[model samples]
Target: MANGVMIFMALYPLRYLKTKVDRLGKADLVYLLTTSVISIAVTAAVVVTLQNGITTYLLAGVASLAVWMSTAWWVGRSRTDAPGTRER
Candidate 1:
């Protein structure tokens, strides 16, 4: 159990999710977390495909992370941004 938590803690995207927990509320939290996991998996695939060198793979990871995080945040915000609805 301890090992599993430490592995999850290593994911920096979860840190961003952590900061947004209060404002995002329960529903969006689930969305963001699921998105975060998908982002991690996709990033790993891209990094593995590169396989050129450490520098290239690292860049792939960073670039993909930026794209995924941005898209997730934007989608999450739009979903919660209806005229009659407000983040809680």
Candidate 2:
């Protein structure tokens, strides 16, 4: 659960930074931080409530990786599609 939250925290920054680079304001930073913290808290709560075991843990790991990859792809697509944004 903690690991999942950490993964989300790390990936979220990348997406937030990419999406908000041009705007790059304090409000954006605050929003990103708030969302990240909330996501972590929610993930921890769910994990605690469910009390996941080894098999569930492995499944969670796979799900986390899938989410991370999908988010990365979405971010990449949005970045590339933005007006005046170059694909790198």
lDDT agreement with native, every candidate: 0.57, 0.52
Clashing pairs in 2: none
lDDT of 2 by residue, 25-77 (tens): 32244455554555455545545666767655555445545554454444444
- Which ten-residue region of model 2 has the weakest summed lDDT? 21-30
Model 2 quality (TM-score) = 0.41
Encode model 1's per-residue lDDT on 1-88: one tens digit a residue: 4234325624644556545543433225556666666666666676677767767556755765675566565665567563345879
* Pairs in clash, predicted candidate 1: none
Model 1 misplacement above 4 A: 1-27, 82-88
Best by TM-score: 1
